[model samples]
Target chain A: MTAKLSPRTEIRLAGEGGQGMILAGIILAEAAAIYDGKNAVQTQSYGPEARGGASKAEVVIASGEIDHPEVLNADVVVALSQEAFKKFASSVKPGGLLIVDEEKVDSTSAPQAIRIPVTKMAFETTGTVALGVLVGLTGVVSREAIEKAVTARAPRGTEEMNHKALDAGFTAAEKARK
Target chain B: MAVKLMQGNEAIALGAVAAGCRFYAGYPITPSTEVAEVLSRELPKVGGKFIQMEDEIASMAAIIGASVGGLKSMTATSGPGFSLMQENIGYAAMTEIPCVVVDVQRLGPSTGQPTAASQGDVMQARWGTHGDHPIIALSPISVRQSFDLTIKAFDLSEKFRTPVILLTDEIIGHMREPVELPDFKTIRSEEYRVTAPGQEYIPFRNESGDVPPLANFGVGYRYHITGLYHDQVGFPTQRLDEIDPWLERVNTKLDKHLDEIALVEEDYQDGAKVALLSYGCSARTARHALKLARAQGKKVDMLTLFTIWPFPERQVEALGERVDRIIVPEMNLGQLAYEVERMAGRKKVRRVVRANGEMVTPQMVLEAMEG
Candidate 1:
């Protein structure tokens, strides 16, 4: 079943510090704001450690002005690590969407979650594949918008690779939906 | 201009450059470090100077020195660094050096949390430095406001010849929002111009307005600047006549221009008996709560203060007279609420406060409204 979203959609991307979740959050916000002409605000919180600690970035997208720049009850939660899943899964609203990395997060506790091998796909292609998977599953932002944002923000010499990774994510989402 | 998604700290750095800021000296600190980082890369592209000072004290001193040498200068820091810069901040005020200090407050008292948000420095921003002094503190509620307010901070500092504080918190500093910045050519900042020739210049002469024209050092106008009480020519003095005038001018300069300096947004409904008042990150929460409260058929007024210092007493007192009660939500333990209470009366003001590194939720403010 397709995930239903509210007028104000709150998305939380959680992973380890080095996993580029913060960057994913920024790209997602840009996709909604710059490309789709929606209002978006992205805020992040991480541990003091630079790496190997739980980090989460939240994006609040709305058709109107976003007064509170944080996720009160996340409409979509993407967890790429077991710790992230444990910490943020409960924050997802009832009947909300949860997409977990199948290999990294063992149990989402929500049986209806859409599980995908996000990190493995990133290992095979590019590290930004999870963001692509998120957009594919929820379609919170248009696919073309996300692609443009990712390309605009991609590192030098890695745009093509990241584009391929996003294609793989969409393919996986298509299979899961079927 | 195409809209670009920019973080609040990054917007501040770009805003500084747009406001004709030619020098940045700051020590890296969480949340606020992005301001220094962006400036470090972008300053040189515009023929501006950026220095990674050894500490916040040195950073504060460096900005003041640059300003004295005739550059629009700024420094950014968190709470600990803000504390270290207190003495130099007072020095800037005493000498009437025009500079901007951006304080991205985190959970504080002393390095309480490196990555959390707080409005704990509201009082500190006003009175952190010792003694009575005039200060202009502007706080922004959004990333776009962050950019706009940073430029205002510089303009106000130059126009007032006083140190201005951009007192933002971690949430507003790190959050990202899409902003279409105005063209650089369209922006105007107050420049320090000495109309009087070097021979006829009196650095602190209160001849016309409260703010006397300042001349950059090494520009032929040689004058003494000290932390001590000074005369019209900036010379050190102990006499009552010289010190009294100096104190009067420095203290009341900002007060005379309260109409121009106090920036606030007032949203009032017809015959609204309740009002919501807040600033900085907390203002965002209050705005959300105002919508929720109004949706539930509550007549509520909301006031968002962009300029926090020099208090904006007249507007707030006027608000107090109009409303039966005012609610304040802030990410601190009643710092600004105290001011609201003093203006609106103790029984007429209620506070929804949090100091635990998390924002004051909109629900909390809504509950306060109901209570």
Candidate 2:
């Protein structure tokens, strides 16, 4: 059964503790597991400090059961902070996708990288940066699956703002692609 | 069936409710705290009861009392809290009460790393309470299995009229995964009923079966219940005739059902030379490592145990005979390895362990396999 899911896609989301990356990882996993009907496992590791500490969430999406939940060599790395980018830049698999926040990360080590002004767009629109990066990840995955996950997981009264942020993210990723 | 993406802890709570567990009493602890939280919210909606006890000791006692009053009951805790519940847990075992105790183990001797995962309590779950007794402990490696095994735990506890432990860890307790759970309406638990009025009801009658029928306390069945060695009438007994039979019945009930109690998953390839044995979260590590090894063209077989306690001696011995070397990886420092060594002999069993907060990675197990 696992043979069909050979070369599983691993996504690593790295940022500070309070940036909602854990929730973002869960949304990504839900998109794969519930919306896409693929087997997915999401795990997170954070320091004792609640904020301003290195934190990471990893999701392994496959067509079969996920044996190890931890991400080893990531197929996609989303770095929302300079610290996160410097630490996890090398952990990405060769020729894998590296998405970075343009203003946040200065490292240019990744040969093939996509820069999205996620924080600036969020601040200029929703006044929060977490959902923007999460939505932009959809450009790398299934847009419909991620949008559905955001609708299902986002708290009430914030759905409209989140949807708008998601649209902005899609636009930003599209512009980066061009 | 509706498929929902849920954390292992939430699935466990839902599993308990589906198993007809109506009462839960627990004090919060890390990793395992979510089980209590979910149950506290869901149990009420299902016409069940949930209480936050002062501590783990009271929590264990409360569940025992609820079970005696004719409700399926459970409690969840971590290593330190589990230690505090030992005395009352033995009380449930001695009284033959039906209940489930969930121990989501963390790294520990005393207040050890709370958020980290570990299989350190394997020995403690089996021998935590003193005296000769029989116990059933089931460990699940994935979130889906966590739900299924919780139901199984309740079923086994009710069937054998004993306390069963749902042994899990922080990794599975916190990891979120998609699962299509079993339909609740189709699930059935072993039944307990009152002896019809006017007929003599012996709570500990040891004649027909090892497990005497347990009647709910308030269901017109007036019987004494105690923690001491008890006679057929439930009164404390010291006589050899009464004590010997009571002791024998408790110990052999699980032994007789060893086939039902010992559940394992084996993946063997033809002409495989090495065997990797693991349980709980470490089993995931073993499976990942096995896949890596197989991908590299290494010949290895894997045995994953869902049943941890009353150790799967027969299965381990067979694996030991089939392969020249056996590797045991656990979150603790060789807790389950000790039992594997005892069964497969110390020389054949190799131990790979990590006690830190982090998980045992595939690389660690792969390196041990290569060595």
Candidate 3:
């Protein structure tokens, strides 16, 4: 009997409408497709309202063409708000990583979560929600790919601050692993 | 040249620029508004022109006017706005103006859902303008195909000297993917230019071929244009000799060039008993279902239609001969399926449809396959 080596990676990012989660998904997808030379698709959902409503973006990166673009059971889920954390906590696959913003999300019920002070770190460095979770998912992606993508896709004049946010996220993930 | 992650709407706008389309006039409508927004930002950089008109009606008129001025022009809209632009679109057809209209469809008999995705505009695109005039429509199934087919839409519009419609639903219009676009210099189609000067020019004359070279209005050419059936010199004519041949030429130009304008993708397994025919958003579901069916040891062929109008009857006829059953899944209820039943026999056709602004699932298609 033969065994499969690597399966497709599905990542879902959930937050409020103004947190730039859609842009974050695009950055991650660009990293996988343009930098790593894989196939990636990014789909997003948001309420009619432009901001303050629930928003979510899903990214699927595969070594081959993706048949279904939507994420069925996400391999990694990042929740940036209490509502999103409650909604998507159970949709992660078994043994999958569930990342929550410790300062903003109430993780009282999820002991298995890898909680990080993402909002605080991002605010201190970039003065915005800088997609620290995307940086944390570099364990699945790569540091170089995320770095290049962040540098390339970020808005003009914010490159230096976004790089600092990326460094902070990488450091936080390493410390959590310990 | 460069690989970039782009939304499908953004890619279409860039593809238009790459195809040497230099003028865009559109009114903003949901799911399709981004096409206008991107062009507003990108057009001026390429020395092209972009104008947000008072409404979709004027937007359609402006593009037609720009095309008559010898610049390739285009517009984008959704259902309600598309409904508004039909009159001018018919005018463009009657005058044989070469332009492109992109309808990034959303759910609607009337404003059903602003942001939701649906393939409900297939029939509207084919029969929207209230005439039996010739038109071409293409539906793209993915973000990358959206870019490629938008270029093809311009190419066909210029080559045939007729208005071409790109009928895309919100799903493919909004999804983001990484694409390596072709160089603009390499992919651009040749622009139309007048061969003769003043008094020697005939605006609608086809001395050698079916299509006549269009001359810009101010470029030392004196001619008249109207929505009425006109003679080759562009004047309204009541005589059958002038009117009948004009109608014949305008209506049959696309039919004569079906080989070049009808774009399709076919994946057939030898001796497969069933084939799935789909386009736009539903093509995504059809492909996934085909993969699932193959995994379960079923033989199913797939055909993805890029060109939806002029019907691609040649390819449909060929597929009908090889397969016993044909399955069609669209967002609307049996719109394209009705045509499939006609070509492939009603007894051999199966339809799976939904119009509630939600995608048809792969499991739904698989169950229909098993049934």
Candidate 1 lDDT over B244-323, as tens digits, reads: 88888788888778998999999999999999999999999999989988888989999999999989898899999999
- Runs in model 1 with CA error above 4 Å? A124-127, B195-199, B206-209
lDDT of 2 by residue, A22-96 (tens): 888888888888988888999877776777788888888888768988888887778888999998888877767
Off by over 4 Å in 3: A1-6, A102-114, A120-131, A134-138, A175-178, B191-195, B198-201, B205-209, B238-241
lDDT of 2 by residue, B294-350 (tens): 999999989999999889999999998899889998888888988898888899988
Q: List the DockQ of the predictions in order.
A: 0.92, 0.63, 0.60
DockQ-wise, the better of 1 and 3 is 1
TM-score of chain B of 1: 0.98
- Which candidate comes out best when scored by lDDT? 1
Give the TM-scores of the predictions, in the order they appear. Answer: 0.97, 0.93, 0.91
lDDT of 3 by residue, B1-371 (tens): 77778889998998999888899999999989999999999999989999999999999999999998878899999999999999998998888888999999888989788888888888888888887888899999888888889999998888788889999988889888888887778884776667346557777773433888778777788889999878888888898978777777777877768888888999999879999999998998899899989988899999999999979898988899999999998888889998888888898899999988878878878888889
lDDT score, candidate 3: 0.84
| Candidate number achieving the greatest DockQ relative to the actual structure | 1
Which candidate gets the maximum TM-score versus the true structure?
Answer: 1
Q: CAPRI band of model 3? A: medium
Worst 10 residues of 2 chain A by lDDT: A124-133
